[model samples]
Target: MIQYLWFDLGYTLVSTNREDVYQKVLERFDVFRNREEIAIAYHRADKLFMREYPGVLGKDSRAFFPWYIGTLNYFLRLSLPIEEVLEVQRDVARECPIQWKAFDGAKMTLRHLRSLGYRLGLISNWDESARAVLARNGLDEELDEIVISSEVGIEKPNPDIFRMALSQANVTASESLYIGDNYYDDVVGCQKVGMHCLLINAYGNRGVEELSYHPIITGIQDVAAYLGHPRVQLEINR
Candidate 1:
């Protein structure tokens, strides 16, 4: 029996609207890079940041802020001094809490699952700011546990974080279901720990095709259908 359902945060239960945040920050410095350019730079920055910083973020916001500024400066190639870039980064960080929000069906779906006797938890690659965001959106009360990468000192796709989550949930991997939007981190990460998993493709964004072993939902609301619950007869319309 499925005793627990763990979810990924950023694109799973919550929507970051990162592009808006990026745009707002960039505008402060009069940087007019097009969306495509920003996307390319941000992607490059992410790879480098993950490789270098790993799980240092979230443990202490003070340390990560500089790393974030450096990453942005490197990608944007703004040639600004460290101080100038740091100022921009600080501003961006301050605005992030207001930017993150829960998706439309996230709370309702979690509540529904809880009512059906499934314990709910969260395992995300985020930091302490996640606490405030969850609390602000009232999602904190819906979760039984929250394991963050910064707090746990391990990031997803590493398998160790997944193991940590399972340990916290007090359930074996086989008896839990992990859901997230990221293909590698959420799907492959949980699969590494032998957990059943699902991917949420909210925007209908396409990149990775579904494998025979991979089950997917177009939105969080469709989770009940995937669970085969008697009362919630929704379908995966995608």
Candidate 2:
């Protein structure tokens, strides 16, 4: 009975090309950290930043860079000037949109869902760059609406953003399905708003079969079969 489908952007629709991003950082910025060092520092900082701003959405550069850079500096144990850190942050912000790529079958899955008459939209905890990334990857036009954390000033793991997305689509909570990669943000958030959610454990890294309020899918293409589409059944059998 779902009439609307809303998806999370990062790790769901498209993911950052971390290797490329790391290479760019090393080449463009003056840093002594090796690739492995940077990777660990980056993940630690990223996780900390997400924790700090769980329900606030905006561009990472503008809203979350300060804390991220601080964490990076600590991890690297380097006393970088604020200006240098800001410069690096800006570079990351600029490069991410260009480097992000949609997952295989993402567009096909979205188009398939649209053809089924289920309204498609995006609910992301990202900044303005997401629009460009989506447009560049041919996903922007396919969505009926996009609610970003930066634009709405509310982030995932908060029911208000889910409410906003539903309001924009004019769909009731019970009539919508929210899909995302993060358990706390997508599943917990949407469930709080009384909406059904599906987790996208793309690599099966979660090691979880199900949640109390939602199920899990390995890919967007699998969503078709989950929804009982005959075409998807054929695809699955093949």
Candidate 3:
């Protein structure tokens, strides 16, 4: 029986719409594209980086954004120079620092889970800003612990981090469940520590259907249903 619930921060409980940010940045260069298409392109790029270039997202923004935006541009067929893209990204960052918002129903789902007597915590590969982001969205109050890579010097896909969270929560791996968006990191990492896991594939195109070891949910709201009926196959709600 699952007694403790842990989650990843980015793309799981909270996310910022890069499509909107990139769309506005592209307009400055007279490059217009469909917002939906941009969203798809960004998703593809994100999966590629996450799977092939683990920990790339945790690097300094100066090093990370150019590579990420370049890949995004390639998917969108923008053909813009990386230098120009980087400049626009900087301008946008200055004008409006990237804000991470909790997903729809994220707080409610977490609160419900806690009320049901499940201990809640966070295990994320984020910098010092993880706490601020969670607190800004009022998600921090819903969690019992928050373990971050920057603070622990360990990252997911590394069993040590998962072990740390389990230790901190004083829960056994057999009684814990980890939910996150990354198949390679969250699912694999938690499994290494003998914990159950669920994947959050909101877009349904993350290419993880081939792997059926763990269940998948479209969003955090589906988590409640999964917990209530652990044996039921969850239909992708996207």
Candidate 4:
């Protein structure tokens, strides 16, 4: 029986769909921009950084904020100070809070799982302030454990993060399951360390087509029923 559950943050617990976040940023900046246009701009900025900051980006491929700011600066063609870029980062984080809301059925599933006495933990490739986002969304108090790449200096697919979560959860890898969106990062990741896993794919990920091993969920609610929890039938009033 599974006793512990580790979850991916982006696209799992929270929805960081670039288009959704871009719309909020445009609104906050008063730019009067189209969401598609803004997303393209975001891509341009990141493409520049990947070509430029090879060293930094090489070491940390999941440097989300850096890629975000770099892409913004490059696309906007503005030469703002890194500190100013950071201010914009903080502003986007705070003002665009809705971009990071729990998925349609996530909060209720988490609450139900918690009620069932299952140990829930979060593992994400996020910065030091990830805890703050989790706190803002009220997911912090609900989780029994957390492992962030920025804090631990190691990232997912590395297994060290899972090891740490194992230490905190006091369970064996075989006794736990990890749920994430990314194919390589979440599914292959936790599995590399011998943990059973699930991939939460809302978009019907095509990359998983060849993978023969893991179960996939289109929504977090599916996981509750898969867990065999009869209380999983409760509706999420959101």
Best-matching candidate per TM-score: 3
> How much is 15 displaced in model 3, in angstroms?
0.8
Candidate 2 residues 57-147, lDDT tens each? 3343567556666777786677667676567656775857437888766887888888898899999888778799899899998999899
lDDT of 3 by residue, 79-117 (tens): 898897888877986776767888777787787787778
Clashing pairs in 2: 55-155, 57-149, 57-150, 58-150
* Candidate 3, residue 204: lDDT: 75
lDDT of each: 0.74, 0.74, 0.84, 0.70
What tens digits encode model 1's per-residue C-alpha lDDT throughout 56-81? 53356576766676677677777656
lDDT of 4 at 222: 77
How do the predictions measure up, each by TM-score? 0.66, 0.67, 0.89, 0.67
Q: Which ten residues in a row have the lowest lDDT in candidate 4?
A: 49-58
Candidate with best lDDT = 3
Off by over 4 Å in 4: 20-98, 231-238
Going through the candidates in the order shown, the clash numbers are: 0, 4, 0, 1
Off by over 4 Å in 2: 20-98, 205-214, 230-238
Q: Which ten residues in a row have the lowest lDDT in candidate 3?
A: 229-238
Q: Could you give candidate 4's per-residue lDDT for residues 100-156 as a string of tens digits?
A: 666665677888888887889998888776888788788888898999988888887
Q: Predicted candidate 2: what Cα RMSD to the true structure?
A: 5.8
- List the candidates ranked by TM-score, beginning with the highest: 3, 2, 4, 1
